[model samples]
Target: MDRSTGSGLSFAKRIYLPRSIGLGIGFMCVAAGLWPLQPQPWVWALLVFNGFLWPHLAYLLARMSKAPFKSERRNLLIDSVFGGFWAAAMQFNALPTVTILAMMAMNNIAAGGGRFFFKGCLSMLLGMLLGLLTFGPAFNPETSMLQLYACLPMLVLYPLALGWVSYRLSIKLAEHKQALRAVSRTDSLTRLYNHGHWKDLLHREFDKCRQGQHRATVALIDVDHFKAINDGHGHLVGDSVLRLLSERLALSLREDDLAGRYGGDEFCVILPNTPAVLAADVMERLRQELAEVRSELAPHLQITLSIGLAGYSPMQLDANHWLKDADQALYQAKRQGRNQVVSAAD
Candidate 1:
């Protein structure tokens, strides 16, 4: 689902269950505590509606609205108002009154933090004032054992539900973070490592080579006459050619090999644990593979690759030196009439 709809659904779910459980139990506490005062039939009816039906009503009111989160926030404030009204109606009987106010405050804080909690408190006061105006100056400072027992279910279970929601949210966030990181690392078209990430791997491979006598070779591959390919067959055909070439290159390389699009029609590869000759051999095999490709873009056209190979050396100043060597060899391959592999001398 889209973010707003999913978020709305989550808000509805958050309210539906615990509110269902807690409010139903809360009504019983208020009912027992308010019994001595002999409230009107309408007051008992409101309590029944708030306890058994308000949760469903609030969920529908939020979920069906254009902006669910905002509607749900308002619903939470309404819950607090109902709590406050019930508190005054029951003559603020100690335990049930404390439980009602505390749970609604927690809901406000969880929904919109401290600022919303203040607003909820204000809503509570408004409800209390209405109750006072309706039935003046009622007070019952004591709580019976039965009333205290009724408050228990709401106090213990709702917080556990809140904790479970928080935990699941954390896991979903972590998965999204991992997916975003993967997108950042990959090239959009070729599905290979992008330039910057491939460069990082090159540097890491260089560092590993410097630590020991591990052999490694880097190659720069250029699609011969790539501009002509694009101009003659259109950019769409040019893109298909690049994708085809990348697929062939992937199939030719070993599992440990790293390949990347190095901008335009140029690609690069780092072959760990391979000598310059072996790297050239692999590229030569890839060259032969390209020779056999029959393009759908132009029936008579066959794409060719020019590759330059360079191996690690003690005399090389840095990773850039290795890259430069590969680049020089690529230039030589291009100059030697294209569609061939050239290796830098040891």
Candidate 2:
């Protein structure tokens, strides 16, 4: 579910029901107490809806599914489940009590962690605060200034606690998400960007070049006689050689250069803002670095790479056409005896 797009907001909206409902209930009750609502059936109904029914409903809904194991919905539902249970408990008990208030505060903190902590915590806290303020006079039967000051803890402590916990959890979730995204874009074996990511990024760069009135180069490199390496040294050594070459290419390439495992012993390097001459120089350096690394890994390993180079075409829509042209040139390099660089423009 490529949630990286605008569609990702839909995922968030799906799980918002429970928390939103609980928050709504809490808000109404708090509002009623603070705004001087005269004793009325509808106002009382509002209190009951906010304090008890909302949270309870959220909790019950969360328990219905055990699908949290593999989806992001699980994370969203987690908040709903916790908030719902807390809401339910509040309904059967005294709303203006410190114990119930504290529980609500803690539940809000847990439910709204990740990038959404502050907003979530504030939302839940506001609901409870309004509810308590609205119902405080009714519960305590005291309207004195001193009595109201004494009850101020009901307003502050819960929100503060909610804020602290939610913010902390938000940090943790953000870190976890970043780590996951990093792993997703990387090749497990070669530690370079995988083939799919390579294609995506290449096209993206190509688009940028088209808009910018600038140029970028793409180089396709194939390990010369890779089949023989696998046959003679076995797949394990072949794997080791590929890993070493990937590392060397990554380390030796300039910061603007992007390298990818295009599949098997083939690699692709996209050099942005580079002309053919500069790209050839870069590739020559890469060839030397890779050759040295190959010698170190296996003394007899004489691996060589045949490279085909092409540049961005402002007239072309995407990089695929240019890539195909580079690929044909690469085939020519192999035909003309491997271990050489061939330029499509040549």
RMSD of each: 2.9, 11.1
Clashes of each: 0, 16
TM-score of each: 0.86, 0.61
Residue-wise lDDT of candidate 1 within 1-346, one digit each (tens)?
5535778778778667778877877787888888888889999999999999999999988888887877888888899899889888888888988988998888788778999999999999988887887778688888888888887876787677767776877898899999989889888899888899999999999988998859899999999999999999899899988898889978888899999998999999999999999898899999999989966877787989999999998778889999999999999999999999999983
Cα-based RMSD of candidate 2: 11.1
What C-alpha lDDT values do all the predictions have?
Answer: 0.87, 0.64
State the lDDT at 342 in candidate 1: 96
The alpha-carbon deviation from the true structure for residue 300 of candidate 1, after best TM-score superposition, in angstroms, is: 4.1
User: Compared with the true structure, what per-residue lDDT tens digits does model 2 show for residues 221-272?
Assistant: 9998999988988888898888888888878888878999999889999999
Which portions of model 2 show Cα errors greater than 4 Å?
A: 1-147, 295-297, 314-317
